[model samples]
Target: MTFEEQPIDYSNYLPDAPQARSVAAEMVATRQSEQVKAALFSAKQFPRDQQASFNRIMQACQRKKLAEEAAYEFPKGGSKVTGPSIRLAEVLAQNWGNMEYGVVELDQVNGVSKMEAYAWDIETNTRRSMIFNVTHERKAKGRINKLDDPRDIYELTANMGARRVRACILGVIPGDIVDAALDRCRQTLKDGYTEPLTDRLRKALLKFQEKYGVSKEMIEEYVGCGQDAFTENDFLKIAGVWRSLSDNMAKREDYFNITKVHVPSNAEEEFLKLQEVEKKEDVVHDISTE
Candidate 1:
C-alpha cells in the first residue's frame, strides 16, 4: 500500500487570505455590476413618471390601515420622537419607481451580527447604503442578558436591520415625496373609518387597555380630553404612541404615568395573613406584660 500527500487548501481556514476572500469578493462584485447595468438600461428604456409615482404613493397612503401605521413615535429626553415608520418607507420605496432597496445580514461572529442595508435609484443612478452591527443582547427589567438562542438573535437582528433599511430607502427617495405621503396618511386617518367614529374609538380604548394596561381614563388624560372630545389629531397621536410601544421602542411608562399596584399572589397572601396574626399576638403579649 502507498500513501500520497495532498496539498492543503488554506482558503478553508484563512478566509481573509487573498486567494479566498478576493475571489469571493470579485464574484459578488461582478454579479452586482451586472445587476446595476441591467437596472440602468431598464431605467433608460422606461423612465419613471414623477406624477404617476407621486399618485401611487398618495393612493397607498390614503388607505386607512396604511395611514394608521404610517408613522411611529417614541419618547426621548423628555420629548417625543416621531417619524415615518418602516412600513411607510417600504410603501414609498415600492411606489417611488425605478428604485431598489433591501437589507442583508452579511455575517455573524462573536455574538454580533454585521448587516448592510442599501437603496439605489436606477434612473438617476443614486445610491445609499448603511452598514451596522447588532449585538446579541436582550434587556429586561433593567438587566442585559446575552442571547445564545439562534431564534432570539435572528429576531433582534431583523428588528434592528429594518430601521437601517428604512433609513437607506428614505435617503434615496425624495423628501417631498415622503412628506406628501405622510400628509395623505394623516388626512386618511382624520377622515375616520368605515366604522363609526365612536366604535373605532371604543375599540382603540379596549385595545390599549388589553395590550398595555392603559385605561381609557389614562388615554383621555394623555390627550387632555375625554373620548367624546378626542379629535382626529389626538387619535393619530395615540396611534403613534401605540406604534412606539408595539415596537418596544419605548415603555408605557415613558408616555403615560403607569402606577403599579402589586396584587398579592396566593403565597404572598398567606405570608401577609401570618404577619397579621403574629402582630396581634405581640400586641396582646405587650398589653399583658405591661
Candidate 2:
C-alpha cells in the first residue's frame, strides 16, 4: 500500500479528543508518570526560557501539594498545559493563525489502518500533513487477546499525531522514520534530474522553493547544476526534493549522507546550527539528580 496525501476539505476539520482522552487517560497517565517527567526533564526537552517559570511552578506545586499536576504542566500565561504536543499546537496557533488539526482514514485497504495528520507551520504559513500506509499490529502480552486490548486506533492516532507534529512541525527529531521518508523523496525526484541555470528558470525555481519554505542553500545547490532549459521531469524532481525537505525531515547535513542528493559545502552552516541546538537540548535544563 502506498500513502498519498488526500486533499483536505475545510469543512472537515473536526478534532474529537475528549472521548479518546477519557478512554486513554489511564494509559496516557502511565506513559507520562513522574518518572517519565523526570527523565524527559533530564533529557532537556523543555525550552530554556521556560526553565525558571517551570521551577517556580513546580516549587509552588510542591508547597500547594500539587506536584503531580506540576509534573504535567508549567505556568503559561496564568494557565497550564499537560502534554508537549498540545503545547506545540498552542505555540503554533499563537504565532501563526489559520491552524487546523484533524485525523481520519478515508478507506481501509490492506489492513493498513492508515490515518493522515494535518499540521500548519508558522514559518511556512501553509498546511502540512503526513500519511502512513504502513501496518501497526503489535503482539499481545500476558495472555491477553488482541481483541481484549482497548488501546485501539484512538491511541494510535493520538500517539502518531503527536510524534508527527514533533518531527515535522517542530523539527525536533532526526530519526530513521524521517530519514527514510527523505530518502524516498530523493529517489522519487532523482528521475531525469537536471539543473537549469537560466536566469528566468533560476529565479522561478528560487521563488518556488521560497514559497514552500525551502532553505536558500538547498535551492542554490540545485539551481547551479544546469545552464539549459528545464523539463517536466525536472520540475517533478525539484518539487519532490523541496517538498520532502520542506517538512524539515533530516538536518541539512543529512542530505550529504543521502546518496544521489547533492548538498553544497555552504549548507554545512545549517547542520552546525542543528548540532549546537541538539547539544544544548541534551544538557540544558536537566532535572536535578538529587
Candidate 3:
C-alpha cells in the first residue's frame, strides 16, 4: 500500500497561542549544560589572539550537542526496535525563530517516501525549503524491513538536511574558492577519470590540513596522486571526498590522517581580506548615507 498523502495541516502541530509563548520563553531561559559551561571556560584559556576562534569552536560544539539533543529522545529499547525517531515537530518548534523548519506530507509514490523540508533563511526573512525523496526499499535484501525504523528515518532526515545546510553555508564561503574547486573537478572529469577532484574538494582538503597539519607525502599517498601530478581535480576532490569523510569524522573523537597538500601561500588570504574590506566599506557607506 502507498503511504498516506493526506494534506495534514501542520499548523495545528505548530505551537500556538500560549504554547508558542511558553516554548519561546523556555527556549530563551534554557541554561547551558555543565559540559557546555566547561567547554566555554576551557575555550577562554586559549591564547588571547586565538580566543575568538576558540570561542567559535566551543560555540559550534555546544550548538551541535543541543541540536542532537533536541532532535531525538533516547527512550529505552529505542535502539533495538527501530532507529532513533526524530522529534520533527519539536525540532521545528525550537528552531522556529532562527530557522524555518516545517514538515511536508509525503506520498508513497513509486515505492519512495517523498518529503519536503523548510528552513528559515537568515539573509532573507522568507522561509526556504527543499523537497527530496528516498526510496523505502533498501539496496540490501534484509534492509527493506528496517526502512521504517526510527533510527533509519532520523539518519535519512539528518543526511538530507545536512546537504541543504552545507549548500547554504557554502554561500558564506568565498565564491572564487568554490568556483576554483568546481573548475578543477570538471577538468578531472573531462580527462577520462571516473572521479576527478574539484576545486571545492581542494579547499576542503586545505581546511583539513590547516586543522591537522598533515605531511605532503601522506596527502599524496591518501589522494593517490603525486604532488607534481596534483591537478586541479586532485586538489579540489575534497568536496565529494568530504561527504564520506564527514561521516567518518563524526564518529571519531580525534582527528585522523586525511593527507594534506601544499596550498599556495596567499592564494585565498588576499582575496578573502579584500572581500572583508569591501563589506566593511559597504556597511560604512550605508551608515554614512543614512
Candidate 4:
C-alpha cells in the first residue's frame, strides 16, 4: 500500500513569527515566598480577586527586576544634547522573551528621514509603534549616526517601542511596588473623588521616597481606615503639610515628624511650633529681600 504524501510543515519556517515563541514566557524559576507572604499579610484588606492579580504582577516584577531598572526622567527643553537619548536596550535584552517579536525600519522621503518601530506583546496581543523625525526640517545632511546612517535612529526608536510592549505585558514598565502605587495614584486622580496628590501635583512633592513618610506602624496606630480602605488623602496632615511646600522644594523632616504622633490630636503643640517657625522664616525672608 502506497503511503499518502505528507504535507509540507511550513510551521517551523517562520522563526520570526510571534506564535513560534512560548505563549507564556517562562517566569523566573523561583518563588519569593517571603516577599509574597509579607505582601499578602500587608494586603489582607484587598479583595480576594485583586490579591491574586497583585500576586501575579508582583512575581513578574521580581523576575524582570533588573538592578538598573530605573525610571527615565523627562528631559527639560533646552537641555544640552550631549549624547543620543536614553536607551533601554539592556532592559529589553534582559526581558527579551517577554516580547513576542518586533520590527524596526527606516526611510527617507523628500529629504525627511523617518524611522518606525513596532513591538508586539503576546500577553496583551498589543502592537506598539513609534515614529521619529530624524531631521525634521534641518538640512538633513552631515548629522551623526542618526541623520547620516539612520540605523541608529531605527534602533533608538525600537528601544522605546520595546518599553511600550513591556508595559503592555507587565501593565507598567519598571514594574515594582513603587510604580504600582503610582499607577493607583494616577487612577485615583483621574477619578478625582479622593486624594490631594493629583497625578500632576505629585511631581512637585518631595522625591519619591519621602513623598509619603508615614511608616506602616504609624498608619496602623494613627489611621482609622483599614489598609485597603486607606487612600492618599487619608494622611490628612501629611498631605496638607506637603501641599504647602514651594515648588520643587525638597521635603524636610519637619513634616515627617507628624507621623510620630497621633493624627489631629496630641499634635497641636508640634503644629503650633511649626507655624511659629514658618512665621519667623517669612520675616527673615522679608528682611533679606530689602
List the global CA lDDT of all models. Answer: 0.87, 0.44, 0.45, 0.42
Per-model TM-score versus the true fold? 0.76, 0.26, 0.29, 0.27
Candidate 2 residue pairs in clash (backbone atoms < 3 Å): 195-226, 197-226
| Sliding window of 10 residues with minimal summed lDDT for model 3 | 78-87
C-alpha-based local distance difference test score of model 1: 0.87
lDDT of 3 at 197: 49
Q: Point out where model 4 deviates above 4 Å.
A: 1-67, 74-103, 109-113, 121-125, 136-178, 181-290
Residue 46 displacement (Å), model 1 = 1.9
Q: Rank the candidates by TM-score, best first.
A: 1, 3, 4, 2
Writing each residue's lDDT as its tens digit, candidate 2 over 1-290 gives: 99999988865565567866786987767875965456445434432333443333223322222211111222235342223233333333333322345566645555456767665432233556788753444444545323223367456456656655543443422233233333333343343235543544566557654454344444445544443546544544454344334544333333322334443344675888889998887676564432
* TM-score (C-alpha) between model 2 and the true structure: 0.26
Best by lDDT: 1
Tens digits of lDDT, candidate 4, 98-190:
333343446767545565545543333345565654443322247543244456545554544555443443332234544563343334333
Candidate 4's displacement at residue 33, Å, is: 42
Runs with alpha carbons beyond 4 Å of true place in candidate 1: 1-25, 260-290
What is the lDDT for 233 in model 4? 47
